[model samples]
Target: MRAIGTIWMVARREVKARFLTKANLVSLGLLLLAVVAGVVVMDYFQNRDTDEPTFTIALAEQTAELRPGLEAAAAGQDTTLDISTMGAAEAEEAVTEDLDAYISGDPAQPEVLVADEVDGQLLGLVTGVAQAHAMGSEVAALGGDPGAVSEAVAQAAPDVRSLAEEDPSGGMFGPAYFVAILSTSVLLFALISTGALIAMGVVEEKTSRVVEILLATIRPASLLAGKILGIGIVGLIQVVLLGGAAIGTMAATDLLADFEIDLTTAMLMIVLWFFLGFAIFALLFGGFAALVSRQEDIGSVTTPLTFLLFVPYYVAMFMVPNNPDTTLTAVLSQIPIFSPFMMPMRSAFDAVSTGELVLSVVLALATIPLLVWVASTVYQRGVLHTGGRMKLSEAFARR
Candidate 1:
């Protein structure tokens, strides 16, 4: 109970001290504003465009029979192809004279005009239609069944599903990718930003000689724990704010309506990883900050650790597309050092099994105590050593 009180007091103090500062609030406000603006701009662009493509085609006089097949193909794609029945010479003239104008010209004007370039899928449609028309003409010449040829063509028509699903209102590549990217970006920023904040807080207390006074009243371990708990709450608040903003933006734009996201599961994973990731990085950062006597030395001390954090991020990117199911991913997922980033990503894709997820959580939970012990020991030894930057070897060598 006494230890809990000390931790609570430290946490409250850290939250007030950091948040009440002008610099911190200003930075947070700016970041939020930028995020909101970006969301708005992206939404606007995405919503503004129509899905249909415009195509224009000049059909030869003899190719009048091809019109129905072409129309059927274009209809499937929600596109209109302007068909003009004209002589071969007239069709060639229209295309050669002005390609764009000919294609864009009124469909009723002439059948020999050029058409606009449509989507690649529409190219297949055009080919199917032309083939069907050719088959019909050949059947007519051979005195065969035109109905049979038409039936075969209909059977062979491509089964094209919408890139944008109608019922859920989610796009094939858009919402899922957006969620994955947003989650990754948010988690990366949260871990790095909050970890650095913890470092800065530690450095500030040591530099101000405030920690010495606090240490006299409470155990160093207690102080460290309290500081971390307090700062971690602050980090959680920041994440909630950012995450809420993102979710609200998506909801406002009706982007979430069509997409099926396991929000409950995702939120749970996010909160879990946030704390675990924070605990792992914050303690290390705090210890590193203590080793430096001056602010200038802080950057140098944390640089190597920062690089370590980046390694998992890079690996996550590479692994997201490839072997999301391989041994490497399973190994990385279970490793606490990489779980904060890698596990969340694997969860996003629904690639991890229940056993793997449980094992990952257990491993991460086990690592926390070991990390905290090491960080606290380093902090206790290096905090008072103000002569020069303490070497990691020297800190470990001390009792």
Candidate 2:
């Protein structure tokens, strides 16, 4: 019971230091503002009225036969082009004033005039019009059906079949791939950043010799537990706020109406993963921190753990977003440290099963006890040393 009291005292200090700071509140506000701006931009694009370029172009007599062909090409791209006909003088005036481009002269080599560099969409339209007109002219002269030739060319490739029940083209929202990736990445960043803060705080106390006075009454294991619990709670609070802001923004904007992404399930995963991920690192950081007597030495001792954090993060960012289907993805999502970042992301693509996810959570929970034990041992032996950094081998060799 006294041990618990000592731990709570240390934990209270850490929680107060982290969450009660004015800096944390200001950063939270700024992050929320950024999130709102990002959500607005994403919403605008996602809910845009058309997938096509809003274009106005002038057409001439020579290029009139190519209008249908140009529209056909735009249709294939899932974009529509607005086309209008005009005389040579009017085409030049229209393009110069407000239109996208002006088309005149021969259909075989239509002349296009623009105020600046032609847009890629407009370029595709003009080029398709010219090519189709030229081909049709040739087919007509050769006593063949121009319409049939155009149809055959348009469908040169056949559509393939998929055996999977889920949409290969990623259903309406593709399980909200961008949102899933962004959310998981944010969680990872927050976990690492918060854990780093705890480590730096430990180093600060050790360097100032404040830990010695505290250590006289408290068990090292209790101190380690208290620090981990306190900072983790603060981290969880930030996670809740950040995740709530994002989820709220999406819900308010109705940006996810067409998607199958379950926000409740996702948020739960984020909470669980963030806790597990933070616990292992935060405790490890506390342990490694005792190996150093100075703030500068903090980074060197914790470098390997920092790399460990990145492996899951990079994989989650680069690989998982592309669809978490590879054997590597499958294997990593079930592993302890990597699972925290990997599973939440894999869930976004519907790549992981419930059983697999539960197993991952179990593994992470199971790994925590071993880490706590190791970190406590390191803290017990190395916290009293003040000369310089202690070697890991030496720390282990201690009674």
Candidate 3:
């Protein structure tokens, strides 16, 4: 009961130290604003109507007969055009500013004028219209009806069919991909950033001998546990707020309608992964930071762990999306070290089975006790030794 009380006290201190700070408050505010702003911007663009006419062109009187053909070609290709009739000089002037192109010269063989490079779709529309007009003229000369010939040519096209299986997760740019990226990115940021804070806090306390005063009454393991729990609570708050803001903005803007994510399941997975990942990282970081006395040496001791964190993160970001159901991803997602990063992303893609999730969680949970023992041992020995950097073997050695 006393140990538990001591840990709770330590945890409360950490939370007060971090949560009550002006900088943390400002940072939280800015992060929430940025997240909501980003989602709003994406929603605005995603819902914007793009069906309106985007290309404008002016036709001279001579090429005015080509207007109907051009309009027909544009409409057939599902392109919207804002076309106008004007004199050749006026068309040429408008092409430099208000118009995308100016059409003049012969009806069948017209010249297209533009101030800059021609748009591919616009150019294609012009070519198709000119070819059909020239063909119509030839058909008239040949005594066949031009309109009927054009209609016959338009109707002649091969029906195309694809044999590839449709991906339910919507390929690379679908809702699954969006969730995978979002969840993984948030995990990466939370774990790495918060993990560093745990390490730096350890180093700071050790440097200032604050841990000595605190340790007089509390166990080393208890202090470590308390610190991790407190900072973790704060970190979890940041994650939930930022993630919830993004999701809420999406839902409010109707962007969530386009995404097929099971919001409840995804949020649960993310929160679970965050706790698991943070526990593993915080312990390792705290233990390693005890090896060094100064804040400057914290990075050197924790660099390897930081690198370890990125391996699964990069794999999750790059490999998992492309090969969600692959053997490699499956194997990594089951491992304790990699699962924290890999499983959340895989779950987001709906590639993980319930059995797989349960097994992964069990494996990760099983590793925590072993890690706690190791980290507690290292921290217990090294937290008091404050000279040069202590070796891992030295910390593990019994007095």
Which candidate achieves the best lDDT against the true structure? 3
Query: Compared with the true structure, what per-residue lDDT tens digits does model 1 show for residues 298-372?
Result: 898678778878888778766764566789888987777788888777776667899988888888889988998
* lDDT agreement with native, every candidate: 0.73, 0.81, 0.86
Model 3 scores worst on lDDT over the 10 consecutive residues at 45-54
TM-score versus the correct structure, for each prediction: 0.75, 0.74, 0.86
Candidate 3 positional error at 140, Å: 4.9
Mark the regions of model 2 whose C-alpha exceeds 4 Å error after superposition: 45-52, 55-96, 99-176, 318-328
TM-score of 2: 0.74
Worst lDDT 10-window in candidate 2 = 167-176
List, residue by residue over 247-312, the lDDT tens digit for candidate 2: 888899887776667887788888988888887788888888888988878888677887888887
Each candidate structure's count of clashing pairs? 8, 0, 0
The lowest-lDDT stretch of 10 consecutive residues in candidate 1 is: 101-110
Q: Tens-digit lDDT track for model 3 on 24-112?
A: 99988998899889888877776674344468988888888998888888787778889888887576668877899988888777888
Query: Model 3: residues >4 Å from true position, as ranges?
Result: 32-53, 137-148, 168-170, 173-178, 248-265
Please list the residue runs of candidate 1 whose C-alpha ends up more than 4 Å from where it truly belongs after superposition: 37-50, 54-73, 80-152, 156-178, 254-260
lDDT of 2: 0.81
